[model samples]
Target: MKSMKYFLLVLLTLMGAHYVEARPVTLVTLGNSLTAGDGDDGIGGGYPTRLVSKLQTANPGSVLLQFGISGDTTTDLINKQLTPAVAALNAAPSANRKIALVWIGSNDFFGFYNYTITEAWCSGMGLEACENSEFGASADNASTILAALQATGAALYIALLDDQSKRPVITEPALRAATFPNISDEYAARMATHLSAYNSRVQAHADTYGAQTVDFFNTTIFEAPATLSDDGNHPSGAGYDAITDIWHNAVTGSSPSSSSIVPNSH
Candidate 1:
């Protein structure tokens, strides 16, 4: 009788362990240049990488995947990447896998040259320009991409575009001379207006999809001219690190190393 009781206890413990292990959550990031870390040496060490590192440190068992690429528009992702990736994730053995991060739309705004003639010059020089000239999902075709991702039952986190006016590259005299004959305060304000509409659309989509939104728009670091890199657009390594912290807080509901508990979505 004593032996039987010990055997049953061990069996139950093993079963519990198996149960917990069966439901692994998989996090995936989808986006364009910013998501791909284009301006940051092309190693893909952008915010997604940092976000994954932080999450893994916090939750040892969670799996993270990045599917971001340089110069991919929302239309491109929806047509080329999103479906295939999600299908594969669904087929995986872990029934509890979930997507957790998605940041896009900077390219959409930047492509349009909304702020100044510099963007136009860059496009003229064969650099990637914002394709969404019309503004919002209508412009970038984000609506379909967002909807499909949400349909997969993955919990999502969406980040707003960083303030473009604060980018250092835009103000660089040399780059300015190369890209635009004249970049004025009026041009900057006009660009902001267009980009703001895009950000608003992103937020609206997030709400529609039940995704949590992170507002980089109002963040001091993202809006500070000095925090950007030489190009004046992409975040420096330090800036990316700060963004990682913000994402960590938004998703996990606690700062790094804090005792705050993240609730399971199940």
Candidate 2:
């Protein structure tokens, strides 16, 4: 069967007087603020840019298209970015290799718990019930997106949620005690557990689709003061650089850099 396919290709080449050429790999990203590069200096100012810098050094003509939005949820990715990401993959030749990134779910949790979300919903659903529902929905959407892209024969690199309880948005111990004193560290701990479950969902989806899962659960940049920007939620330049290293290690299957050591996606 292999020989037959090669013979047909040769015959077609002779008839058309044309030669087959390889296409550079395309990297399409779909996620939230991290993928959109929200907390970075500007649009295209996040890890993707650093990733491009790394990829370009080897694959000069490689294409990088990021479809991240600052506050996108898993549903937002499905409703908004999924179609475009598939379109981008389809535009390339069938034989070309492709890579995509799907790092989301933080906002699903954040959106549910934000001050503007109102307590009525939580009181009705119960806090644990709400968390479980979000977790299930996030996993389902991630699976749908991964299956569609996998059908195009592209390699995918899905990321797990970072430990957001450490982010400034949730940390300020004193302020947290004053603001939501009833549930300060307790809330953070609950979020950490939920995110871990979400990461497991992402990993299961990746395994089902022959994709790679990138890790961010144990990264210290978010926990440390140096890597965070003034907003505290968004990563500083140094933080992005550290994230780039993490991504580089993930995509290339290398050991983590000096910035981090959390390796296994599982």
Candidate 3:
């Protein structure tokens, strides 16, 4: 009788352990308007939200907590949010935590706009403006955020900013005619120069902190059809879906297996 009781106790303990191990993971997303799901026709369905939906279907029970605000620069995240949130999560009792997705820096680039210029000078036109945007994240600031997050011991996924030059707000014919009738490709190239610098900084920080970098910069949504969004910039629902596919693959460590998961035509 004594041996049977001991055997039963051991079996019950093993079952409990298995149950605990099967629990879903908890994730957090931190960033700005893009993270907040801005241009998705008010669905609040930005890439992060799309990502959450994908993860839930792929791995049931995974929960995503969002801490994003519109127009938030990288500096804002580090100063106003990241530290406290990290502290709170660290204090939580849950052991099945997985990843933190960070997507910031668009505002930093957009905030560079000062006045209309020919495309010929678009690249340099924003240089002075970019340097002056107080909210912009210097390379050092990005590194700091990465290091702080790393200290919390969570897996990190960092996204690079999309090319801002493609946004309709900057490229629309009507807006361009009204704003700067003589826009030149040079102006666009100059803007690209500054954007490249900022993106490189972000990539360097991710590399330094050992975080995986999502290559949103060169994706088809931005490069092909270039008309990804009606607005010319923020990804349409379809655009966000493409981003979702990229992130899903990054997290799952496997290529997306079906077209059902791919973003529908825009």
Q: Write the per-residue lDDT of candidate 1 for residues 1-266, one digit (tens) a residue.
A: 99985675577467542112223457777877666665554334787887766666645566667787777766667776787757755655455457657677665555455342355554564522333334645434555666777777777777777666555545565655555435455655566776777777777777777878887888866545555566656666677767778877776654566722243442
In candidate 1, the residue pairs with backbone N, CA or C atoms under 3 Å apart (3 or more residues apart, or in different chains) clash, namely: 111-129, 111-130, 167-232, 168-232, 169-231, 169-232
Better of 2 and 3 by lDDT: 2
Clashes of 2: 0
Candidate achieving the largest TM-score: 2
For model 3, the superposed segments whose C-alpha errors exceed 4 Å read 1-23, 91-93, 115-137, 176-187, 222-229, 258-266
Best candidate, lDDT-wise?
Answer: 2
- How do all models score by TM-score? 0.73, 0.79, 0.72
Off by over 4 Å in 1: 1-24, 39-44, 92-97, 114-133, 138-140, 179-185, 223-226, 259-261
Please list the Cα RMSD from the true structure of every candidate, rounded to 1 decimal place: 8.0, 8.7, 8.9
lDDT of each: 0.63, 0.72, 0.64
